[model samples]
Target: MHGEPAVLSVTRYHPENPIKMFLLQPLYAPLLFPNTTSDARDHCANERTFLSWLRLAIYMAIVAVAILVNFHLKNQPTPLERRLSHPMGIIFWVLSLACLVTGLAIYMRTVTKYAKRRALVQTGMKTQAVFLVVSAAIIAACALFLAAEVQASRQGHAGAFDVTFVL
Candidate 1:
């Protein structure tokens, strides 16, 4: 047994092919069939964490859509207004994309962590540094968004609460 190669022999499934058992068994077994109840619980928790990240990504995507839809170059007669409008729109667009990409990156990282933890049976909690970094980035983006809005309003593009009632 010491000199024998490491191989999983599943007589009921693939007795004829030991290679398939060696390759596919370990990879799928934990996910498909947990050895213990605690393993199943851990997997469930991992899935929940993954879903939380996915929800955050979706929220960020919604924010991106809102930014794109709400911030646009309206009718501007002056050259300064037009210049400011273009750059402001560009800045908003970049920030929107940054938020979306960062969200997706975080989601993907969570997925990787989940998979690794599942395979390794690790019980370590996620670090607070990640949360702090993400929070700071979000706060900065919000501040920039508000600043741009204020600038646009100051440039007389449109009143902050300008509303047109079409009957």
Candidate 2:
């Protein structure tokens, strides 16, 4: 509307898995570029950061699912343990679910071929930065959940072992 418009170019898609890539974009896009830019400086944000977040999220989620899932669960330990069920195990499962869902959501949001910069210092930087923070935080949460679950399981196993040993 004013002077000549500036050029805005975005790289085309070449994800590891074109389909799942979109499912993981929200977690990765902002992480890669906390600030939207066509910048060519080392200080500037890059795509690697975004992918790393996704990597961590995926890793944490898989670990969580692996640890929490696939027990026959026939009158089984009530998720956590006998007493009240292990809170950490339940929490870990919930966190893992959240990570998977959130990652899918973000990835879906960014599937399109190009995302233009509407205006300089507009929503992209602010929005993407927020997304990045959220992605990182989610990963951390997943890790915490896993940690709690592991600790609880160890305690449960130890308690059980001690009781048997007493006999």
Candidate 1 residue lDDT tens string, 1-167: 45744343232333223233335544544223323446556556656665665565566555545444454454323343344444544554454454445444443443343333334433233434444555665676566555554565565645554432212
**In lDDT terms, how accurate is model 2?**
0.43
- Model 2, span 19-118: residue lDDT tens: 5444454444432322455433422222343454466556656644544553333323333333322343354545545545554444334432223222
lDDT at position 137, candidate 1: 56
Query: Number of backbone collisions per candidate, in order?
Result: 0, 9
Residue ranges of candidate 1 with Cα displaced over 4 Å: 1-31, 71-133, 152-167
Can you give the TM-score per candidate against the true fold?
0.43, 0.31
Q: lDDT of each prediction vs. the true structure? A: 0.46, 0.43
**lDDT of model 2, residue 164:** 19
Worst ten in a row by lDDT for model 1: 9-18
